[model samples]
Structures are given as C-alpha cells and as structure tokens.
Target: MSQKKTVYIGPFIQCKTLTDLDICPNGMIGVDEGGRIAFVLRDERGRKIPEGDGWEDAKIVRIQDHGFFFPGFIDTHIHAPQYPNAGIFGKSTLLDWLNTYTFPLESSFADLATASRIYNRVVARTLSHGTTTACYYATVHVPATNLLADICQTRGQRAFVGRVCMHEMSPEYYRDESVETALRDSKACIEHVRKIDPEFDLVTPIITPRFALSCNTESLAALGKLHRELDLPAQTHISENPRECDLVRDLFPESKSYADVYESAGLLTPKMILAHAIHLTEEETALIRARDAKISHCPASNTALTSGRAKVRKMLNAGLNLGLGTDVSGGYTSSILAEAREAVFVSRHVAMDEGDEAKLSVEEALYLATRGGAKVVGLEDRIGGFEVGKMWDAQMIGLEAVGPETTELDQSAGPVEVFGKETWDDLVAKWVYTGDDRSTTAVWVGGRLVHAKEGFRL
Candidate 1:
C-alpha cells in the first residue's frame, strides 16, 4: 500500500469488451498516490516516464516477455463459512447437502476464533488466486458476519459482505430466531461495515435472504424492505436444483414460479444478484430481465452439485448481465481462473444439448470472469479493465517459455507451456485451459499490493 506514485511497464492485456481483449505489447500506465490511473501510453519504449510533473523517482514495475497484466477477478457468489468443505460434496445435492454437510459446518462459525482463522485464510487464498472483488455470504451469527467484513477491509480486498437470513424451515440451531431478529442482526452487520469503511470504497454490505427455500414470506418481505430502505445491493441463490424448485412450489403455493417468489417479496431488482440460474424457465428469465437483476453463473458448483447447466448464451442473447461465481465448497475450488475455464466446459455441454450456437469462446468466458463480473457486483466503472481513470485492480500473469536448453520442467509456472509459437489468442487459451494460481505472480487491488508469490518483486 505505497502512497508514492508508481508506473507499471510492459505487456498489459485486458478484456475491453465481451468479445475483445485489449493487448498492448509494450505499454506504460501511471498510478497516482491515491491509486487511480492517471495516464496510459501504448507502445512505449524502455520504461520512459511521461513528460515530467515531478515523478523522477516513481516506482517502476516491469513485466517479463512471457507475462502480462490482466484485470483481477471478481467472484459474485461464495460462502465464506464453507471454505473448509471445498471438494467434499460427496453424493449429496442441494437440500440434503445443506442438511448433511453445509449447515453443521456453517454453525461452527458461532465461535469467533474459528471464524477469524477461516476468514483470514480464505481471504488470503482468494487474493493469491487473483480475486480482487467478491460477494461473500456469511452465516446468521452477527459477530462472525461482522468479523468477515473486517477481515476483507484489513486485507485490502474489495468485497460485498452479507449476513444470511433464513427465518423458517432451516434447522433450529442455525436458522435466525425470527424476522425481527434476522433484520436486527443484518442491520448490525451493515453498521459494522459502515464503521470500518465509511465510504464503502473497499467494502460494502449486501442483503442476503439465503434463497427462497430457506425463508418464509414474512422474513423475505421484511428483508426486501430493508434492501429498499438501505439502498444496498443483494445476493441470493435461485433455481439451482429441481428438488429445490419443487420445494419452493410446495412452500409457496400462491407464487407462479421460483422467480415469482422473489418478485412478490420485492427482492428482485436491478441491485439483486441471482446465483446459479440453471433451471430458469423462459418466463422466469423474462421477468428477471424486466427487473434488470444480475446473474452469477457458477459452472463449477452446478456440475459438482448435479445441478443442470445454465443457458448462458440464451441469457446473453436476451440482453442479460451475467458473470462467473466460484461458489466454493460446492464448487470445490477458490480459484476464479478455474471457474473461468469450467465455464468454457459448461458452455460446451450446453452446446451439445442445444446447438453449437450455445458455445462460449475463451474470450467470452474471460469477459464473464472480469468485465461481466464487475457489472454483476456493480463496480464496472471502477474496476475490471485498464483505462485512464479506473483503479488498478489487476494481476500479473506469467507463463514459462520452453527453450532448447531446458532439462527439467519448472513446476512454479504450472502446466501451461509456451513454445514461442502461440498467437496472442492461443497463448491466452493455453492459460485458460491449464493455468493455476502458480501463474499469478502478483495481485493488486486499487493499486495496493495485496498478494504476491515468493521471489516476486516490483
């Protein structure tokens, strides 16, 4: 978190649009003391400073030939309390999975010591994987939920923290006691975040109803009213499982559909982020579009939890805003790079059943990972790309080049091998398919150095 001016020079790549990547082979970008990008110059030679305004001693970060700087990732849906259970779903689906593995694990967060240890580790891990922004769901406990916001603030990660509310049908030991208690606890968490980051420049509070099945009409309506009154963004699950949809129908017989449940409660709005819209109907999609709500396509979790594939191409064709979510624990990973690649495979599966037109290219998936994710979290104007005024929320990605003298392969750069034959697009595709956190040498959020691998220096 240096207050002095800094300049990053060398290859820079970012998604300028959904279908285009802005690849500047040699570029120079300046960041002022307050962390906003001051100027951008393309094809600059030899780390030359912009004609001076007293920046002779500015810090310089130069990237290697095989590396490029890309925008940091955004995870729109993930459970902060379930990070330990990643890759442990076994043979369970939604409801049974919640009862058997999810609830009991989440209930343990009532302990502050347990909450602090896990929150710190998960935040560090995600930042290591180049995730600068995330929308996190915390348990019903107020103290632990507030602790998560504090951790994100301290770690310099941009986050939307929400205290989950499920006043009915959830287990007695874990559910919120009543609607009043649910709203009261949620307000306390919001106030706690405001106290820490008063302007919400780094962290903000989000409304969480924990999906329709876990909440009754009274609690949902009350939470919805709170959302409107506070003018805060919200995140929740939707149509992730067939059994869950059936349960929603039985529980609220008056509602027309799963989307109707939220609409009736006033929870569906432009600020709402719906995760895993895998089984959404045409009408339901239309209603969501009409409301201008956002969608977080968690492909890794959908396939792991046995949820059906989401029709992402259709959503885009219908002019919907969509992004990627790790949905960790259910997703079995914290890396959004893995999530972006999984989205490619999920789109291929979708194309197999529907048509080839449903397929998503590597460029499209990366856009969902960066630009679309920024849109989902309501920070498109501030982050997600390189521009004159946007903050520097980005990661430096390095790929190992194979030379003739190589005897043993380097394990630090992961499995992606660049042999000097790849086009710019091919190189990007290789990383998307096989790259891991090893390729992320350094990460920054709002010009603050948050995480870096061993031996990496500016």
Candidate 2:
C-alpha cells in the first residue's frame, strides 16, 4: 500500500542546537509515504513549488497566521499505570509515597480490564499534549504490560514499554514472585512487543528494574544480562530522594554509591536511561558520564515530592545527555510543555542556591524536551525536530491575538496572546510559559494525523 505524500507550508520553529532555535517564517516540509521527512524548504521566498518531481500532486497544508509548526515533544520517562494516581500524593515523599499510592494502583493492573482503561487514557492524554514518543514503565504483570504496548501502537504513538522488575522490598502480592519469574515475565513482554512491531519502528521493549531499593542483587544482575543479550535500552531510578539514597547505601554496602549499585550489577551503559538523578554525587555524575548513560531530569516530580533540585547545568557541563520526564502521578501533569516550564523554574531554584550559572534558558529546556529526549531513548536519528530524513512527529501551536475588533469568542485561543509586535523568540517564550494542551491545535506522529482539536482539519 503506497502512502500519500503531503506538503506542510507554515511558520516553523525548532531548536537548532542547545542554545539556538531555528525559526522560519515561511517554510515548507515534504513528508513521503513511509512517514519520513523527505525535504525541508526554509524561507521559500515566493518561489513556486518544483514541478515534475512528484510534488505537483502532493497535498498541501497551509498554516494560519496565529499558528506555527513545531517538533512534537518526547517524554523520556513516564509511568503508564500511574495515570490514575496523578496528583494524589499528600505530603508523602519517595519511599512512603511508593507504598501508599504507587504500588497499590500498579498492582491493580493484574486485572487486565482496569489496565486497559488507564493505559488507553494515558496514551490519548499524552498524545493530546503533543508527546509523540514516550518511554513508559508498566507494571510487573506481563499481560497488562503488553497491553500498554498494544495501546500505544493502536493510538499511533511511539513508545518503549517495559515490564517492571522488582523482586524484593515490595509487597509480596504486588511484586515479582522470584528472580526467575521476573526474568521470564519480562522476556514475555519484550517478545510480545517484538512480535507486534517486528522492526520496532514505533514501539520497542525496554528493560525496567523498578529501582535499586525495590530489586535484589540477583534480579538486577539478571535484568542487566538480559539487557546485554537482547541489546535493549534499560530504564530505572537513581538518587531521586535523600532517604532513597540512604536506603540504597544500606542495601548495597559493598557498592561505593547509589549509582555504583547499577554499575556493579552491569546495568549502567550507553543504552540505560536513569530517572530523577537529583542528588547524585560528583563521582556518580562522572560514572554516568563515563558510561555514556542518559538522565531523565524529572523536575516536576522532584519538586512535588520535595526532592531537591538537580544540578542540570552541572550535568550539561559534564557532557551528559539530559531529557525531561512527566513522572506522572508524581509530577502531576502529562504535558511536556508543563515540564519545560517546570524545568525553567527548577533551574532558577538551583541558581538561587548556586549562582546564575546554574540556570537554564527556554531554548535549552525546549531542546531537552525534544532533541535531548531523543538521545535519551536512543532515537536520535529517528525522531525529534524538523530535519529532513527524520520522522514527521510534530504539533501545530496556535496562540491568541488581541486586536481592535476583539470579541469574547476570540479569547478562547489559549493563554498566550500576540499583540502583533513580538518577535518569533518572544512568541516562543509566551508559548513556553503560558501555553497548555489547548495551544497544541493538532498533532501528527510518523506523518499521520493522530490528534486534532475541534475546527482543526487534517
């Protein structure tokens, strides 16, 4: 079946690098049948469309005055089953919150029906926020975990689904029964995802050992070995909370630090994505950088749980790949735009404690939400940004306008307002600070229209 070729003409904005954002007031992008971006014409400058190159018959989508095309967000780390528990944690920090809110809800996933309802909503909700790619942590139940992958595939979102491996320090009823069961069940989920998406073009299975405190040595080692054997990307938590760090120290006395636990278990590698590294030591940062491992900076979750601010500037200075995560339920929001705003605020907190050098600019934060996240999930070449040859994962962002003939109906264009005088940079800043999912008028993944608001036609 041949796919249709579409040409999108609009104002395009994207992070060109860590410090620069490329904004083309008049741009044209061509996406081929296979969902890959085939050509990008920046600032076409009144040139007519090239004819006899198969572009004459292509479908053209033109943007309105108030809207622009931006690359879709990438959520580097999120808990799929925790959607129901979002914003319910009351004064409970890491360990207690896990026992009270996280575990019980995740355990209910043994009932596949309940899992389906939650997984479906989370996938849809994240897609509405323009998250085209996500790295998801599913529960220990293999069926439910596989269902999560299936839901993402059906919803047309890119995802990495993992069956969490936690064989110790968790409630007996909810945890994996043994090391063998943990490995076996994890393998089953991985194979299920493989069978569903043979080439893993849209969905892949990740090795997830819940965290050092939840898993024993044997299970961690086995999961690491599986990570090596299958050459899969792995995700886990590290140094999220001070007490969690203390517990890791006590649990693995032989290891030098919390990061050492994974390093000693043979789990630290370039393919690993470690979440919430808020309180890592100098040596730990060096170790992670040396291993070429990536970090998912979950600022919203860290602040919500009263976890200390992560030194993102330090991590970036150390040459570590960093990305944003909703850490939903803990973070209390599904939108990566919210995460990007939170990232700015979190860096300010760091700057207050450790000078202005610790701060992060809006451009850097947006980069983390897109390009940096692509690196975290090991999809640097496939997703993120508006480059030719990358997948067409993007969103249409519309901002409101205040004019002389303004009426009540015109006020519904979301929180961002354009006075018709702001620069492109200022417009992006307004979107970052005030825009919500409402600003995401439409979303597309792999060049397919996946979500659109009312009045937004494909």
Candidate 3:
C-alpha cells in the first residue's frame, strides 16, 4: 500500500470545549483530511507513520515553536463586491448607503477587471484574517459574480458565492436584469461554476435576491423555485434597518412581516440565510426559526451602521440556528475574532436593556463564530470544531507572546509561567477578546498549510 503523510501538532491547544474540558489535554491533534486523537497519541510517542495506507512508512510532522490550532474561522455573511469601499461607505444608514455609495460601487463590478481586482483583495484579506470559509454576496452582474467563484476555487477556500438578483425597486445604478433575465443569469451562473477543481468541492453557488424591496414577488418566487429545484442555499438581507423594514412592510403589506414576505414567495426554507435579522418581531422570529432558516448575526455592522441591535439571546433561546458574520464593509473588519467579540458585546447590551442580564457570554459568542457559522453554511460536520472525522480546516493562534495580565487569564493561570501551558479555553478567550489577524500566526485548510507567519510555504 502507498504511504499517506502523517502530521502531528504537538503541545498545541485544541478546543476540547466540545466533549469535556476535563478529558481534553493541552497536548496534540493529528490532522489528515479528518482529525483523530489516536494519531496525536502515536505522534507524541515519536512514531512517524506513512502518508497513505502504509502506516508503517509514515513520517512525523513537527510544527516548531507555535501555539494552538483550532477550526478555521467561518464568516456567514460578507460582500465581495464591497471590499474596496469597505470604510468609505460608512457615511449613512442602510438605505442611504445603498443608494449613494453602495449602488454606485457595485455598478462597477460589471467590468470584469474591476471585479477581479476587488475579489482578489477580498479573498486575501479574509484569508489573512484566518477565515477559511465565507458566504459571500456578489454584485448583480452574473459574469462578475462568476469571476468571484473562480477566484475562490483557485485559492482553495471553501465559499458560497451568490449571484445577486435585483429585478425591481432598487436604485437604477444597482438593479439588474428583469425578472426573466435575473432568473436566467442566476441559473447560468450556478451551472457554470459548480465544478472547477478535480474535487469539485471548493465553490458552491447561492441564489441571492437583493431583498424584499428590490425583488418583485414574481422574481422572488422564481428564485425560490430555482432554490428548491437546484437544492441551493438562499441568502439575503432582512429587517436590518428599521427604515428598510418599514419599506418592506410598505411594499408587502399583505404579508405579516419581512420574514413573511419571503415565506409567501416560498423562500423561507431551512437552507435560507438571513443577514442582520434585527427588528424582527417575536412572531417573525418564531416563523423563521420554525423553517430552520439561519441568521447571520452581524453585530459590528449593525452597530456601526446605527441599526438596532438584534435580539441574539432571544433568537438563541427561540432555537434559531445562528452564526456570526463580519458583514465586512459595514463591519469595518474582516476578522471573525472581531465578530465574536462584538457579538458578545452587543448581545450583552441588548440583554441588559431588554432581556435578563445573563443572556450573553463569551463562550456563546465563540460558538456562533465557529460551529454555528459552519452549520449555517451547511458545513458544520465537515469544517467546524476539532471533532474526529471532520475536515481539517483550522487555524493556530500564537498567544504565547501575550501576557496573562493583559487578559482574564490572570485568574485562570495562577502563578506559573502563564502562557507556557495554556488550555483550549485559554487560547480561545485570548483569541476572541485580545487577538486579531495579527494574532493568527498559522492557518490550514483541508489539512494543508494555506497561511503561515513566516514559516512553511503554502
């Protein structure tokens, strides 16, 4: 039998937060396509197994002088077309931004070169932030959107790129093909980019109707039918800004709420992803969660744009499948760490004001950024957590340089060399509260090194 390479990450932290903080040791994790604790044990014993089926011939991989490795961060919502204008479009609230800056900027994507440049920057920035997978929204230009899929496929990043459809009610500069044309473009875009690499696993297409206001019922219905027919995921904004929600109510008065508008059009299914689900009523929340639709809690974006805070704790208690998203341009950062931190912050503020004070915690925020985001994008079992039999998409955060006094670890680490022997929870807490892209020294996807801080080559 041929030999398959064996890799051992030693003395590194694993988020043993899954099974038992008691059973998990701060030792090692072995990763191939899937992670196995047995592999880690063998490596600690100085055994170098073969790369393939011939385990006797395997060679051991030792990563020297680094910190812990955990599952790669996932961003449940981002806009590839808005990368360039990230901080520039922060002038106004949602609708105003959409009309003035966002619409004009997105209109530029019709130029393939422009799209290529922007998409390249978007991919690099997200990767640099240790986001191995992202659910991205592209402009209404189908060709430009497909260019995004191509870039993601080549980069070996797992992504869901949506070809946005806007057949009516958007600013002239941003609206796209008519209902029939939007449907056709979405279909063509999906079929064209379904397979790029041999594995045909990197890129997937999603149908993105801009929103209830931008899409006529006919267009949304057609997109919904296409969503069900192709078994593709559907994503879009909903109840983000109070004004936007008002406009949606005005447009779809026959519906009960923004969520109902989508439901009436047959788009409220389990695979649908709704971004910025703030301002949703209790009934609306119940309806969306009932259908198993997921919410991408973009706390930074909501707060930065002056949109009201989402009741994330309430949604969680309602049993909603929720995840964290950077929402990039609006969020002002690409790091999912920032997402987690802000999720905890905003949820606590909301909970303090509305719900009980015990609603939000740092651990819950971390869950949203990691496992929750993975599940929302339909990649939970494959990409999230350090569980066995899951794809090896993870990042190593080097917190050895951080002082325990700088963090909550002051209480946990006692008097010893605080950074020397840290637990998975210690590493995670540092990453969420104190770390950023700068803190991520190494990253891996599918068991292959993608980004390293001046170490191994990609």
Candidate 1 residues 1-458, lDDT tens each?
45778899888999978888888988988988878889999987765697686567889998965889999999999999999999999999978889898999999999999999999999999999999999999999999999999999999999999999986766889998888998999999999999999999999999999999889999889988999999999989999999999899999999999999999999999999999999999999999999999999999999998988999999999888999999988999999999999998999998988999999988999999999999998899999999989999999998889987887867665677888888888889998999999899899899999999899888
TM-score per prediction, in order, is 0.98, 0.98, 0.88
State the displacement of the C-alpha of residue 414, model 3, in Å, after optimal TM-score superposition. Answer: 23
Estimate every model's Cα lDDT from 0 to 1: 0.92, 0.92, 0.76
Off by over 4 Å in 3: 1-4, 11-23, 33-52, 56-63, 197-200, 355-359, 402-424, 456-458
Better structure of 1 and 3 per TM-score: 1
Off by over 4 Å in 2: 407-411
Worst 10 residues of 3 by lDDT: 409-418
After superposition on all C-alphas, the RMSD of every candidate to the true structure, in Å, is: 1.2, 1.1, 4.6
* Residue pairs in clash, model 2: 86-329
Residue 107 in candidate 3, Cα distance off native in Å = 1.0
Off by over 4 Å in 1: none
